[model samples]
Target chain A: AQSVSQHNHHVILSEAASLELGCNYSYGGTVNLFWYVQYPGQHLQLLLKYFSGDPLVKGIKGFEAEFIKSKFSFNLRKPSVQWSDTAEYFCAVKAGRNQGGKLIFGQGTELSVKP
Target chain B: EPEVTQTPSHQVTQMGQEVILRCVPISNHLYFYWYRQILGQKVEFLVSFYNNEISEKSEIFDDQFSVERPDGSNFTLKIRSTKLEDSAMYFCASSRLAGRNGELFFGEGSRLTVL
Candidate 1:
């Protein structure tokens, strides 16, 4: 079956540190990729998405992700992290043929930014 | 800005008891979805609905689980007989379009604890 994998489970970084979270998917067809974030006590919210365009997609909160078709990867990155950036990040993919737009999500990566 | 809303922020129920989680999706959205995240696990898709019918469902959505858009404003997921494993955070989401390219808006989830 198709699946999404996030390599890091927990990442700790100091404020202003650069960050990257790895994601890979196993679908063989066209895909729509997304990154979502959940802050403490908040609902899941979209950070960025990749439909079909330039491989580099920029999202909210100074976050960006690159879709590398060859590697089946869409990795999230941030240049400078803030203490407020501590949250759980999830990577998701939707197969092109799926009519319902159901998403397959990766096990989330928890990032803790210490001040 | 319009957003999805879920009721009963938290619920605790005995195993085998029936439970109904409710949601009100953004008024303009055409597609509705249900997803769940078990404690310390990845977010998993449960089902998707459109045009008053189910568009798709995952294996996790079995006979014990059912979804209904009972009215113009209310979407509900009913678990006929909850199991201990059913304890998780249930989220409701909606999108303006199908899988091609539409951002999903999610509601604050309802945390269910099946004791």
Candidate 2:
């Protein structure tokens, strides 16, 4: 079984500040990584995903994540953030072959972007 | 874009009672899943359904739980007897297929409260 670890439990940032959320998984084989955000009253929305090829992947709203195979990490980042970004962020990973691939999610990090 | 939708934003059930959580995944999606998140805990995978059968499930999905797609559109999870620990946010997700390219789309989630 795979386990996801997200070190940052809560993060507070001012508008325009740089952002980074650490995500690490336990599996060593092939895996798919994703970042999902849940605003105060909205559904979970995809931030970005990483499957293969390039280690760095860009997502919507200027968000990006880098898959570091050696570290077993795929950390989410953004050069700058806004007040609208306040939400709960979850990092997930799906390991092994695709047949009914299920996600293993981290404990989630609550991010508050102060205006 | 297409989206997954869930019913009864919030549900309260008594201990030992049965409760069903409903979901309507996006059209054309072939894989469906149910995940639960206990307060302040990681989101846990419950079960995955495809071709109208369960393809995969986690230890968290015991005999007390079952899934069904009665019609072409509605997918449901039934807890035969609710327990206090069953209180959590239940999220429904669907994808085009299992494995490699299966980027899941999730619903707003049904907050279940067992009293």
Candidate 3:
């Protein structure tokens, strides 16, 4: 079975501070990685995705993730976070296309960006 | 831009009662999915539907749970006998492409409270 693990359960950062959220997956096949963010009172939205290509993938709202296949990790990073960036982040993995595109998600990381 | 929509933003039902959650996926999406997140837990995939049938489902989706696309646009998740543990926020998602390639659009989940 494929599983995703997010190292951070809660992270507190001040405005303009650098941010990094660690994510790891245990899947033995070609996997698709994704980071989804849910703002308070809002739906989950895609932050970034990695299928295949350059290891580094950039996404909306100045978010980016690097997929390291060897380590089975896709960590999200932001150079500078804003107060508005306070939200819950989820890391998900889809084990190959044959698995019906089922995404196994990690326990979300609650990001609190203070102004 | 078109987006997914879910009904009864919140529903409170009693144990042993039947609960139905409705969703309207994007117009052009070919694949539909149902996921739920218990409070403080990871979002878990329940089932995936395509071609008017279930393509894949997780262990969480047992005989008590079912999904149907009754009409051209509405997709629904029905629970035969709800349990207290079934109280969670149910999310409906859709993607235009199947498998790992397509990006999923999620709806502002329907919160089900089984009391």
Candidate 4:
């Protein structure tokens, strides 16, 4: 079975601080990676996705993720985060072929950016 | 922009009662999906529907749970006999295609509270 693991449960940062959230997946075949974000009272929205292109993918709201196939990791990064960027982030993966595009999500990471 | 919509932002039902959560996926989407997030737990995929039938389902989607696209636009998840453990936030999503590469649009979740 494919599973996603997010190393950070909660992260606190000051405004303008660099941020990186670790995500790892256990899947052997080809996979798609994604980063989704949920504001306090909003729905989960896609931030970025990686299918078969470059390893580094840029997303909305100044977010980006790097897909490292060898490490089985796709980590989210932001050069400088703002207080408005505080939200819950999720890492998801879809195993290629035969899986019917089912996305397995990791336990979310709660990001608190202090202004 | 078009977005997925779900009804009854919150639902409270008794054990043994049947609860139906409704969703209206984005227009023109070809694939529908249901997922649940228990409080303090990871979001888990329940089922995926395509071509008016179930294409894939996780173990969490057992005989007690079923999904249907009754009309042309509404997709629903039905729980035959709800249990306390069934209490969670249910999310509805849709995509234009089915594959590792497709992106899913999710609705603001419907919270289910079974007592």
Candidate 5:
């Protein structure tokens, strides 16, 4: 079965700190990758997604992810973080093109950005 | 900006009782999905619906669980018999298309607590 793995369980950083959340998946075929964020008291929102083409995909709120097929990795990165960026980050994978919208999500990483 | 909506932000139910969670997907979305995250666990897919029927479901979605699009706007998940293990946050999501490249929009989750 396909599964996603996020390297961090909790990360704490001061404001303006550089951020990188590692994500890796176990799958042998074509895959779609996504990064979703959930702020306190807010719903989950899409931060970025990698479908095809350029390995680097940028998303909302200055976030980006790189899809490295060889390593089955799609890690999210941000150059400078704000206090508002404190949230739970999830990495997800869809194993094939025809699986409808079923997403296998990783154990979320809790990021706390101190102001 | 359109978004998915879920009702009863939190619900408390007794074990063995039936519970119904409701959701209203984005107006133009063609695919709907249900996912759940138990406290301290990764989010897991339950089911995906399209064209008025279930397109796919995960093993976690057993006989006790059922989904319905009772109307054009409302989609619901019914648990025939709630158990303590059923306590979790349930999220409803919708997308304009199927797996390939569709971006899923998620709703504020409904927290279910079974005693």
Candidate 6:
């Protein structure tokens, strides 16, 4: 079975600190990557996604993810973070680009930013 | 901005009883999906429906589970005989099937607790 692994379980950072959450999947074939955020008392929302072409993909709210085929990783990054950026982040992947493929998600990372 | 909406934000039910969770997808989305997240766990895909048929389903979606589009706007998931383990937050998502980047929009989940 295909699976995604998120390296960080919990992270605490001060405002304006850089952020990086690691995501690695165990799949050999082509895959589409996604990063989702669930803010406090809110539904999950797509932060960014990567399909093809550029390995570096930019997403909403100053979020970006780099899909590195060599490492089987799509890591989310943000250069500067705000207190409101605190949320639980999830990494997800579809095995192929086929329509309606089942999505596999990793255990999420809970981020806490201190003002 | 369009979004998916779910009914019954929180449900408390007895074990062995039946429960139906409702969702109202975006007006234009072609694909609809149902996912579940156990507290403090990863979100797992259950089923995907399109064109009034099931496009794909995960192993977690067993005979006890069923989905339906009863009308133009409502999609629902029904559990025949809810078990204690069935307690989880169920999320409904929809996305337009027209583009390569089919970013799914999810609703504020309906939390179910089987007592």
lDDT of each prediction vs. the true structure? Answer: 0.94, 0.94, 0.94, 0.95, 0.95, 0.92
Per-residue lDDT for B47-94 in model 2, tens only?
A: 999999999999999999999999999999999999999999999999
Query: Which is the winner by DockQ between candidate 4 and candidate 5?
Result: 5
Docking model 4 quality class: high
Worst 10 residues of 4 chain B by lDDT: B95-104
Best by DockQ: 5
lDDT of 5 by residue, A1-115 (tens): 8999999999999999999999999999999999999999889999988888999999999999999999999999999999999999999998865757889999999999999
Candidate 5 lDDT over residue span B9-115, tens digit each: 99999999999999999999999999999999999999999999999998999999999999899999999999999999999999998867778899999999999
Off by over 4 Å in 1: none
The alpha-carbon root-mean-square deviation between model 4 and the true structure, to one decimal in Å, is 0.9
Question: Residue B69 of model 1: what lDDT?
Answer: 91
Q: What is candidate 5's local distance difference test score?
A: 0.95
Error of 3 at A22 (Å): 0.4
Steric clash pairs (candidate 1): none
Chain B TM-score by candidate, in order shown: 0.98, 0.98, 0.98, 0.98, 0.98, 0.97
Candidate 3, A111: how far from true, in Å?
0.3
- Chain A TM-scores for all candidates read 0.98, 0.96, 0.97, 0.97, 0.97, 0.96
DockQ of each: 0.81, 0.78, 0.82, 0.81, 0.85, 0.61
Clash number by candidate, in order = 0, 1, 0, 0, 0, 0
In model 2, what are the clashing residue pairs, if there are any?
A98-B99
Interface RMSD over true interface Cα atoms for each candidate:
1.1, 1.3, 1.0, 1.1, 0.9, 2.3
- Per-candidate fnat, comma-separated: 0.82, 0.80, 0.82, 0.80, 0.84, 0.60
Where does model 6 exceed 4 Å of error? Answer: B98-100
Ranking by DockQ: 5, 3, 4, 1, 2, 6
Model 3 residue A115 CA deviation (Å) reads 0.8
Return whichever of 1 and 2 wins on DockQ. 1
Q: What is the TM-score of each candidate against the true structure?
A: 0.98, 0.98, 0.98, 0.98, 0.98, 0.96
